[model samples]
Target: MEKRLLGKTAIITGSARGIGREYALRMAKLGANVVITDIDLSAGKYKETDIKAKSVKEEVELLGVKSLEFEGDGTDESFVKKVVDDTIDTFGSLDILVNNIGGTGGAGPGLATDMEVEKFRRVIDINLTTTFIFSKHAGKVMKVQKSGKIINVASVAGFVPLFVVQPHYSAGKAAVISLTKTMALELAPYGVTVNAIAPGYISTVKWDAHFEAQIEDLVQKVPLGRIGTTEDCSKVIEFLATDLSDYLTGQTIFVDGGLMELNPSSSKIENYQI
Candidate 1:
């Protein structure tokens, strides 16, 4: 196997678990030193989940690449700056940045009209603002080097409304896509490439039991006839991290198994009117 990302140093936010964890591990295997950070710290009264940052860091180190773990809020400007600073100080250079920190605020489903204004702002802060903070800080370092790759983790829900998750989550993700495009254009002159990966219906242990039925129903809607996995998203991130996608920027790649192409599938025949 060729080491596509050899000599590269990558910082991945929310890498304690889920798709972010997969990205960290896969990048390490491809010969990139990885830095994993997450807001979830098991220090206080909160129970430690399986997808903790320490575990992901350990796994990355096991791959024979140096790994650093940090516990901080992604939405914090100073925190994000520190993450970039630490990456440079420890690794000597920053080559790739994966902005994967985002969530629906653990708030259950609700209509756009009924969603609280505060909750909406929180979602935007976590998903969109954090992306901006990381990209801006990382861009500064990469600009000086004249070469770097930045991959933002968007969601298929941003393109097509899922209706199951909050509308705020979808909107924030859409903003992420827009931010990615803008950054790509701005950073292109410096030899930096920025892009986004919109993953669809990934099956993870974090899904609530009630979502199981919804997940099963969604599988039929996917042309590939199966829900996506964390590894599915990881492979795409891996590609974006390598020189193979150097020419690609200001683009959003949908890892939806062809679901994004069809407006309505056979499964949605009953809802299709056109």
Candidate 2:
């Protein structure tokens, strides 16, 4: 059997570690030449994170495909544009782009009342603005090619109010979903499909410290009674990145173990009765 993404080229931001690294690895496994772009860089040599990117690159290379590592802030307009240009210059063309760079401004989750304005702005810049920059530049390239895949990494917080306490991060992710739909609508005519993946409680190295306790609580809340893995999220992305989803666009798929479908009213009533 042949790989689903054979001969494709992909640019996955934040590919240094965590979910982004998983995306790079999974795409490469499918025979896609991946560009691992991250904001983190080392001084003398590639750090552990960069090593992860290099390892994926090596694995892909072993499969007879090319890979590259790029270090830069995905939110910067010039940097993002240059990444798109460099990928085309080096690989000859661009096929897929995964906007996987985002976080809670390093503050974890905080109450809306205590969140600072600057922190809120920074979160928006990192999550929402970065998606815009990549989509805008990559959209142009894909339009010219007349065929491309743009997958924005959104969060389940975008659909429900799960991250309401962390207003900034929640708002930013919500914007990502909205932007995904808008881009999908605009790019549909150009033969390009744009979609968003909204993942919930995915286990990554970044959350390893509190993984166990968080998983227990999260599982109790989820209908599936389990937290998601990086592979779980990657599977949905694989579908969106291929012709398997050619007719699907302007949509957000939540890979949350059915967490979003739960009835808040029923749960609340049960709690009150108890």
Candidate 3:
């Protein structure tokens, strides 16, 4: 809000909607030029944010900062490389990279033993591989500049086991956390900090629409006594994206409402999903 990232450039993946969208808007509010990249730029057709514009890119421009919109598959290495190149060519500097493109890919059976082969692979590619590709290209630019921040979006599922299904999602996120630490060490010499935010029970348009009836029940399990908002997740990204976290690297900050502290075992909880 104080324009801490003034004149900076941030590229957020899967930011057409959900928590990623919040990250883009937050960066823009801090005076950073935002690049809205997603497989579907029109993905937000399901719901609307408070600041209504023709699109998220428009919303960012409304904040008095430049915005670039690129729609492409996150798993495509060529597309990702182009995004990185084009951002540098236009922005003159790559100050921030938020790897927010990931999901369960809900195509396979949920159980570990019963998980579908293709679905599991797709989940890993979208979450882990996508992160690596962006970091690889973006790191090249950041390393040259000798300053940058990379914030990866992980999930509580990566840290703890769940009674619910979706083993592929869990495994993919766990790998992301590991990758973040590795990248942190690799990029530290270049003054590039790599960190991750693992959120829990965030209420997004798609999540709410799917679990609307179970919202209250899910909140009851959270010690905070409420559902987490996209802003809750984005605020943490803000910290990691700014100088405030300059000293921190190779860290995974959990944005959960103390949900992981419980460390609930599968036997204790019945099919709970985070």
Candidate 4:
């Protein structure tokens, strides 16, 4: 770790567990003061990733960087604004914002036609609306300061249909990718870079269980012949968060192990419902 993000402050949404947790840890390891926010700080228990520290905030603090923890709805504009305000109040600067709060959000049919309206809306709010609200408040600060990094986490499902039934998830992520581009254009002049990372078949604790039976079949579909990991996704965030990407903005880097390039599909396993 070369401390690429030394002295910066980063706020990662839904960072109590899963890929979001990885983002928090990686940024902290790079020396950024990390703020962890999620509806449940103990969310990792649901997926069996809870660490000895019991929470991501403590985990980050153990890495020798300042850490802030907030428990709230990432979609709620008020809470998001407070988080942004507090981040600036505490760290004196908000250098990075990773909009990582999102998920499939339902175990229903996930069909575009008959899925419950509530489920569809939940997916969109968590994925797209949260991103918008965070960026709006953070962009205000970054614009005035004229330097910042905003990374939106998307999914390969946004680019192509999935063997899993996640039309709502797909639609929400697609919107995130589009939102990244538009945000980039608006913030570029202010020296703020906005980018999105679309991950494919990542094997998080929850996902590992969800795709347990289909892992082999799914790996075969990926051109790289492997499932992606949280580290794989975090590396892209590292790039977008650091000065290495000073010249890049409004881009969606696919951390899919070449699965997207192959136009992936899985016929061996039955349609997995999310």
Candidate 5:
């Protein structure tokens, strides 16, 4: 609302759809040149409320901010390095990095007993490892600049074991929270702030039928009386990317509509003393 991100540049991964897309739009709206990448580059394919990188880039341009779109894997170090380098080459500065390129995206049953070793590894690679790879490169540039912001997308499962049976997803997100804190601590002296958003029951187009049917029940369980939205998390990303949150670092801000407060059994809430 304040054009808070003016004169900055950001890279947001997995920005083809959902929360990543929203974050990209919000960043651009606030005047940040954006570099967005999603493995899926199709422009109009997900017309049924799908947000493609092409469409996202177009919107960024419409907002009057420079944008570059890429279709690459964030888990690949080479790919990450190239994008970060290219963003610096083009924008001349790397002011922000939003690691929105994560999710459960599991194909097998999410239960630990039913989860395959490959599935567990894949989930971690996509969610946690990607954050590590991307942040490592971005951190280097930000360190030289002596300023930057990094935001990673974690989930409520990372804090409290959800009833939906996603052990692999839970583990991956939990690791992301840890990664955020360690990065925050490592980067603070250089003026970089690292944080993670643990979203709970966020509404997106790519949900299973069961989640759609159980929406009402899930809302009741949430103390806020409604499912979280992409904008809810994007707003927090906006804060972390700007100077408004300068005093905050190595923090995992829960954007779960008070769900974690209601469920105190989580060891995660205590694990993050950073």
Candidate 6:
């Protein structure tokens, strides 16, 4: 087996669990030392669930790559700066950054009008603002290296409404999509590529916790005839992180089963079967 990212280092935020955890594990197998950051670390309990930074680190190390776990709020500017600095100090180079943090918290299934201002702001911080902070700090190190790959985790909500009611979450993810374009342009000259991955209906253990209801009806809508898996998303990230996607930048990849950017009324296919 060949490793494309041998000796390279990657920083993936919110990697204590779910999609982010998958990224850390996969990247390690691809021979990239992994830096895993998550708010769950700040609480020092992994997560309310069983997945924790320690478990992720152990798995990544088993793949024979160094893994660093930092505990803090990803939305904090100072914390982000420190994390970036520590990455360079420890690994000596920052090769890839996966900004995979964002979600709707306590206030579940909310209409825009019914949401509290504070909650709205909180969602934005978790999703959008944190992306900005990570990208900005990570870009600095990549700029000095004169080469880097930055991948942001947007959502299908960034492009279209989902079955769930999450107005603020949608807005924040859309902003991340926009940020991908702008960052790509800003960092292109520095030999850095910035892109966002918008995923739809990815089924995870975490998803079962809050969004099992979304599964039944949503799978039928996907042209691929099934919901996505975290590995499905990570494989795409693996591509974008490599030089094979060197020409790809300033773009958003919709990792849906052809569910997004579709006009259901005008599709040539009347129905899709698995």
Q: Least lDDT summed over 10 consecutive residues: which range in candidate 6?
A: 265-274
* Stronger candidate by lDDT (4 vs 6): 4
Over 134-245, each residue of candidate 5 has an lDDT whose tens digit, in order, gives 9999999999999999999888788776754566777889999999999999999999999888888788766434477677766776777788888999999998899899
lDDT of 6 at 60: 86
TM-score of 4: 0.94
Model 1: lDDT of residue 214: 67
- Report the Cα lDDT for candidate 1: 0.82
Candidate 6 C-alpha lDDT tens digits along 138-222: 9998999999999999998887655345778889999999999999999999999999899987977667656565567667778
Question: In each prediction, how many residue pairs overlap at the backbone (N, C-alpha, C within less than 3 A)?
Answer: 0, 0, 0, 0, 0, 0
Instruction: Give the Cα lDDT of each candidate.
Output: 0.82, 0.80, 0.88, 0.88, 0.82, 0.84
Over the stretch 164-191, how does candidate 3's per-residue lDDT look in tens digits? 5767887899999999999999999999
Please identify which of the two predictions, 1 or 4, would achieve the higher lDDT against the true structure: 4
Worst 10 residues of 2 by lDDT: 265-274
TM-score of each: 0.91, 0.89, 0.95, 0.94, 0.91, 0.91
lDDT of 4 by residue, 1-274 (tens): 9999999999999998989999999999999999999989888864644574867888899999999999999888899999999999999999999999988554445567777888888888988999999999999999999999999999877777675467778789999999999999999999999999999889888888777887897787888888888899999999999999999999999899887676435323336754
C-alpha RMSD of candidate 2 = 4.2
lDDT ranking, best first: 4, 3, 6, 1, 5, 2
Global local distance difference test of model 4: 0.88
Can you write out model 1's per-residue Cα lDDT over 23-117, one digit (the tens) per residue? 88889999999998889733211222444334777778888899888999998989988989989999999999999988775755666677788
Error of 2 at 51 (Å): 8.1
